[model samples]
Target: MTTKVFTIQPNKRLRAVEEIMKWAHVRHVPVVDERGRLVGIVSHRDLMGAAISTLQVRISEVERLQHNAAVEVRQLMHFPTATIGPDERVQRAAHLMRSLKIGCLPVLEDQHLVGIVTEADLLHIVEELPDASLALRI
Candidate 1:
């Protein structure tokens, strides 16, 4: 089903990202600037990547903070984000994900971030072949 989706603005601080993750229980957030233009995408892993290498911060402190920790989202986000349009078929999404080695796709319409689709979304579509045992000739 085609639909619009979650988005965040660039002016929003890192703490906002943390809160969004907590409230929505989502791994990624699409970033739009003040003008409603998509600028980047941030994921939980991206935050973790930064947290892991924070030299001054004790590693234990990061672990203790857990998912609730609020850091600057922009500090950990990936820019020039990859995107797909809503009209695109699921197959294209799968192909792009595999080829690009990415975990999620931000659906866009007219350069605006729309719904997000991940590998998990596609997994539900996999169907078993009927009579697979009979077709097998090992």
Candidate 2:
């Protein structure tokens, strides 16, 4: 779980998201509302999909990028997002992610965004755990 999270407003431009993602080196960004509540979430996949959809026959790559920047974060984010509590177990989060086919989940506390847990974070935790081995009885 990453305690330091980067969030974006629903009205912010895509370019802002891209810049933050690039600077923070994060793939998933949570979208917050005016009250700092988790309203939606955006991933690199979502941005890529938006970018691909904007490709036109006569449009140049630069134009497509600019067009994407004009689009608001709310337009590209996935709403009604699934969130987890800070006290929830890691296994539960992992199961949710696997079943939902999501890369990460925002952690909320009392309806407020707190942290984020990603697949990579889970993998890292597993890697740090004690090794397991089988013992055979003859």
RMSD of each: 4.7, 3.6
lDDT of every predicted structure (CA atoms): 0.70, 0.87
After best superposition, candidate 1 residue 51: deviation in angstroms? 2.0
What's model 1's lDDT at 2?
30
> At residue 32, what lDDT does model 1 achieve?
79
Predicted candidate 2 versus true structure: per-residue lDDT over 29-63, tens digit per residue: 99999899998998999888776453345777798
TM-score for all predictions? Answer: 0.71, 0.87
User: Pairing residues by index, what is the TM-score of model 2?
Assistant: 0.87
Q: How many residue pairs clash in each candidate?
A: 2, 0
Model 1: per-residue Cα lDDT over 1-138, one tens digit each: 234445677656666776687787777778878776778888877766655444755567556456334455566678744688989998899999899888788887888766788776776555433455345466
Candidate 2 worst ten-residue window by lDDT: 129-138
- Best candidate, lDDT: 2
Using TM-score as the measure, the top candidate is 2
